[model samples]
Target: MAAVELTVFQVILLFWSLRTAVSQVEMRCPSSCGNICIPYPFGMEEGSYLDERFKILCNSSSGVPKLTVDGTKLEVRDISVRRSTIGVMFPVVSANCGGKDRNTVVDLEGSPFVFSSENYFIARGCGNLALMNQNQSTIGVCVSICDKNRDSMMASCSGTDCCQTTIPSFLKVFNVTMKGLDDGKGSSGEKQCRYAYLVAQSWINYGSYYSDVGGDSDPYDMRHRDSVPVVLDWGIDERVFESLVKNGSFHNSSYSSTCQFLNPSINSTNQSSTVQCSCRPGFEGNPYRYGICEAGRAYDNYRRKIKAKMAGIGVGVGFGALFLLIGLWWLYKVFKRKRSEKLKKKYFKRNGGLLLQEQLSSGEVSVEKIKMFPSKELDKATDHYNVNRTLGQGGQGTVYKGMLADGKIVAVKKSKVIDEGNLRQFINEVVLLSQINHRNVVKLLGCCLETELPLLVYEFIPNGTLYQFLHDPNEEFPLTWEMRLRIAAEVAGALFYLHSAASLPIFHRDIKSTNILLDEKYRAKVADFGTSRSVSIDQTHVTTQVQGTFGYLDPEYFQSSQFTDKSDVYSFGVVLVELLTGQKAISFKRSEEQGRSLATYFIMAMESNCLFDILDPQVVKQGEREDVLMVASLARSCLRLNGKERPTMKEVTMVLERIKKSENLTVQQESEYDRKEVMGAPWDVTSASTISSFDIGAPSSLDEKPLLHTY
Candidate 1:
């Protein structure tokens, strides 16, 4: 009787503990809000929440309760505990006819919340450019053209009548501005209203805009929709997790919970780091609650089966069944792995992986430096190369932003499928780029060939291309003369290094402003080596098909089909012209006499002694007359009719460096003079002196000789 009672007590105690663990999630918390069940980590009342960030306010003023973010008053549509995101009905802005234009700005700074990466900046209506900006810098821009065929807009926010672009994560604040590209009239012959908003990825589909209206009608109703759902991410401070984990106290604090550090390279408003808490593998529940993680249904069922087998049969029979089950599981895993390997091998051969291996082994490329990544790993890093992960797209391919397993952010280039003629050239690029290393050149991190088409990974650059800074009117800061000069010198130096410093001479046939990237400090990084060529020591030039941008292409190369190192000089000269004049390399808007080519117009202006007439006002204001003339003269020399007449990249690099040093010295002297005046001047005289300094600092036209005569 005593043994039976003891056994019964032990069984009861185990059952009570299990029940308590599962019930912990709802203890002292309001489990429901209206019709929705509130989960752990997210609570309606004060004491139930793990922290203030988890507080979900229920507004009952209208006789019906509605969920809102605590203190923000932003209405919440839904909460996703698994995704670590919240769906909120964010307001959308519109520029409509017969009504005032509205700009919707969402500022999330100083809050623990951030915009989710899965969200997109979407714009609706035809002939509009939607711009999203933060901290006076443009984040994303999308242009919508007038489309009479609204069928395309019905399916997705395709770049026809509607446009969409993915926003980067860790964005605390952003403002949406919509401007008309047409004369305020859409292709539907209506006074089109532009609507722009931030919305969740899942909520968008074909029927969102054009279901009611066929290909001819307007969707905005001329009044604009009030709001749409957008996703926001939340996380805990990393310091707390680090402190608890390091002291071995985390295990005691929470059972079946794991700490996952957010990618360090991701942008964040928080001063410290952030981390996410998740239920351990084989368990599922809210990890924010203590001891709430429960075993998965499959695991619980398996345990019950084992207990039943042990109770009903002999120990030997039960053991034999368990061993057989384990053997079957092992075999299944082996078969799955073998199948995966066979697929990888098949893809490798199809993507010219064997040819790449042969080339790398020939001693041209350093195998250690140039990694060959598995396709699976890249797919995981880039979320299976989803369109939302795209960084930029060009003629060669699209570049997607990805985070490696080692926590490095990279730009993965997914090239379009190529014909057999281009296969050798693609492999050649990998070998050449892997061997060359220069500061201004984009660094190739690795490549992956285990797919139908190859992928190349390069270090991610944050700031946009030089063309954007020059051409984008929404750009907050104007490109200064000093910055342009420095960039010119940097680009010239990079080209020189490619030609002379590398083992084999390399010609960057696609040397244009668009291919040049700018870092945070505005340092130039020459990129896009898709059309580059590497010649052997004995070769002077490679005669190939005419391949280059029209305005920047060398006349000699275009006429003769021969590409020499000087061909790059002509392209570089065009970039220099763009820097001097803020005009595009090619523009159809220019008059017939002005010529389509910026180089031709610039030369004509110089010959006519009207160089200053076409120069950028910013450059004219900041640049010294002599420095401007010297750069113009160098550009003219580079744009010579004959390739042989063009100055070598080495000589061009030397002149630009000299000019940069001279400018630096002049700036230093001016700064010193200003400092002395500030230190020595009386309070009354200071203001007067500052005003006089500005008056005296203006450039004089008489400071240099004629640009045509100078060269």
Candidate 2:
């Protein structure tokens, strides 16, 4: 009788699976266009897609069916419902050998599609420099150098006759322009036609697709096949679903029943709002269509098999089920612990633990100086990164105040989500900071990589940043003229050491007042080395993506994307201006005529002979007039639009030191003169004359030949 009841239950389960499958089949809509599967959110027919923008068109006029986006010639190659991506054939922008250069513009401004970062901006042809622009700004650039040998020219896309760079995420409009370098020469000694386009990154891994050509051959041979596969990310805004529900297009219940909404994440690159959706787990088919997503066939088969097996052994298993469950639970706990440890190891490896270990072994990074803290220790110290312990947050990560097991206080920097491409930079910060042993630079205590996000441990700085002290003054600890001057000297000394005194020349690319942390003594300690880069002794500058605070960024570096030691000088110059004026680097509180840039405002004030008008009240009141003018002049020289004209950090450091020494001498003279009067001793005429002459000559000497003149 028990066996008969088990068989009945199995039959009922099979019936339910069949009913579910039949219902899915009945609800299925037109699901294909050409060979591409038209998922519900994207369809080739009316009432099948989520909206009009999701519509696709099928054309079979040429004896071969092709799927295209509605009202556009762009052909759809593949659709990924799960990843919310689509592969499309995009035209390659070609520049003819001698004809006017051609540029390709793909506008998806109002659509739900964005050029995925997985696509590479590829440029083919020797002596070609390709630029991908958005809103008239160069976002991506690659240069292909000429290779004399024809065989070597077509070998790879490693900047020899071909080059590629990753595109930015959330890129809706792609504009590619290719320019010839050195008269567009190629291996054949003629202007070769260049091809530039956005292609799916995976497609390039398949191998070389371009054919070698002779000198006399037509440069437009690849014109016959004009398009390359490009990947595009697609997503619908959550507001669209809310609008649909309000307009009675779909019931609120149908939303989650068909499609699962993903957790919204802020895309810092574009600041655009887009929400992704996919079919619920265990279901397959059109997620945007109600009742269309059903249990996968494989899942249904597995269920059927499980029911059959259970029917055969149900009575025997029931007698020992409780003991088996308890035993299984114990095994699961052990398995889970092992899995957790394995996952931590995986994260550590992924975060470049092996590379760091190699550096340590190779003596590139001193092993004795840096430690690798356990994730659990940091977690406990920061109270599991509680909000109350949060020190500060920035574009790269958040800093939390924490205490170690040894009763030592530290700052824990928890980085934001980092992709594989940026892992090198993350490890780079570790290596760079480990090599640095300067007193004015924040010390790297260690790092913990056995967590989801890498954590950097740094020496805690009690006093906040120079920016806060300058802009938001604390009555208890006012940034007096002496303190500001001392802080300036300390920061300049640190930068000079980085530029000329370090084992390897390091560039603090993101130098700003905010990055300048103050210690308990109000001395400057340059912090935040995440964006710093070290270069070889012979290298003058590093050509890279433009990065820095807007107003503090070197104009020359911004225009050319070449960061030099002088670029740091330019940023430091802005900090100097901030110290003098006590104004934000980029502020709208000033007049439009000043252009809202503190550097520009300061320069204008100096040029107009109104330097004291915009000077910080504290600086003007306590600072010596000659010394203030001298420092102002030094700052102006550093802020020169031309990088070459700016004084080197070493030069700036010397000028500051000279100014400080002169102030010290003046203070000593006044102290000695007061002591003589207090004791009623006979004043030495030579000493009084010496003091008078020194005071009289100092300002004139500084004005006639500025201290920065040596640079």
Candidate 3:
């Protein structure tokens, strides 16, 4: 009897211990502070969060509960566990120049948060120059200009009284200074109040502050508010979680099933070894909490089946075979899913996903514009890369026309069997393309890296390449002189943007007619960036392996392997020659004297004073003689053997714009003259000068001789 009583006592003790463990695992904590939901790893009290850094304070003295972070008391607006981002209200710094200045400094020194690149640094005031400094170094600058007209001052932040620029990624702390131009002297001789701050880009676009302009208030005036919304990216260190796992202290039951570690490259000497944790597919909720990530509907259905089977165990004996088959099928599906996920992860790592992630985390590349597409989605979009969907094939890869699930048409580029050496180039293309926002540059919609080869998705251009239009004539759509000139101007503008206007200077190593695509509107969109590279602002050249189309390749780059922006100019010059002659860059059918090169042939024709003789008959017929001569001169300047002697893309763009403007004005004048007189003056080509005079804007190297003068 005593033994039996002891057994009952032991059973109760075991049940009590089990219940206690379950209770600890399911312990409830405050989920929110006012409107912001505080998900674990982040909490309002000790023992509720993963670490001291994630602790937040809730203040309700102002009637409404407010969540604040660290000693800065930055008000928390929202927290997203899925995106690992927190929205906080950051104060705007105002400076009154010669008066009381309110320059603010934000320091997040020891926190796990970094300022997101999706925020923009804005400065608002007339004739004020704002500079954002980090670690005493100027990181960003923008100048606001006031309109000369006082009564009709523009109420827009489009560089008039307000200017905005993007902030760098991985930024932890920064300060803003608003310096007035000419010692704060305003049009009214009154000291101007300049406001500067970093705000979420999306918030600036949709916020009510911009639309709240009334009476004489400035449109960008933020004096009424103390702060604006800013985005902060937060992540936990991978080592901390790994240590917990090793010590058997991590109690999050759903962590293994829901969370995956984002391993960014770590620099122990200079930076913290931090990593991001995100919930896995088919799961939702806090990954840092015990059993918080709830399963999706499919998982819930599977659980229901298990529960049903357990409840009907006795009945299942009669239909044992049927139950066994269902169990086997379910097991097969689960195994297949796990295997597929493992393979995808392997491919992702192999295809430079981790390297790209490092670049993104380091703020070297902006992540807002690029998307990671799933392999299955791309496969379906391209119909398994059907032959019929093929758009074009190149040495680098093949492009396919695809329709996404949303019925959006895109051009998908699938790389060939690239070795590890070329992998960096592939990734380089993705990073460089993501940063570009010019209209004439091809838009990178997204990419897929989980397959054997990486895939890049771009906006589809309905019209074919410029090379096809120039070399392969179409009866339905003829290439006119005006269209060619417009295309040339647009291409030059794109190259200029790459070289000068971008956040970083980009060198398009390959610039050929075949690489320039035309959209439905016949607008030029520069494509094929597999060989492109971005250089620092101070870097004049990048020494790389000589790679370019033979005829279009810069001679200096081929010999020295030092590629500068001028290398691209040389290639563009060849494209110009192609436009003028309407012949292949390299033709074996040409005579030995022409050296099988169109560039050489065109130069020879120009020197011999018979450029028109070699020019396409259609070009001579449709284009004005003087306009043709001016363009030919510009092309010659660009094709200079010495890279330094060649005109920059900026100079080329300016000269082309001037020529186009002149053509427009001349056309208007000619139209008026024809209306006034029945017959127009005839041209005397024999007596007229062989070369037309126009400013080519060539570098000082060309100052010795006129661009259009006879050799």
Q: How far does residue 33 in candidate 3 sit from its true spot (Å)?
A: 84
Best by lDDT: 3
The global C-alpha lDDT for each of the candidates, from Candidate 1 onward, is 0.72, 0.74, 0.75
Q: How close is candidate 1 to the true structure, as a TM-score?
A: 0.50
TM-score of 2: 0.49
What TM-scores do the predictions have?
Answer: 0.50, 0.49, 0.51
Candidate 1 local lDDT, residue 580: 91
Ranking by lDDT: 3, 2, 1
Range of the 10 consecutive residues with the lowest summed lDDT in candidate 1:
701-710
Per-residue CA lDDT of candidate 1, range 412-471, in tens?
A: 999888777887777777877887788888888888887777899888887889988888
lDDT of 3 at 680: 23
N/CA/C clash count, model 1? 0
**Which 10 consecutive residues of model 2 have the lowest summed lDDT?**
701-710
Q: For residues 58-109, could you state the per-residue lDDT of candidate 2 as single tens digits?
A: 7755322243342456778787876888888887788774554556576776
Q: By TM-score, highest first, what's the ranking?
A: 3, 1, 2
Report lDDT (Cα) of residue 113, candidate 2. Answer: 78
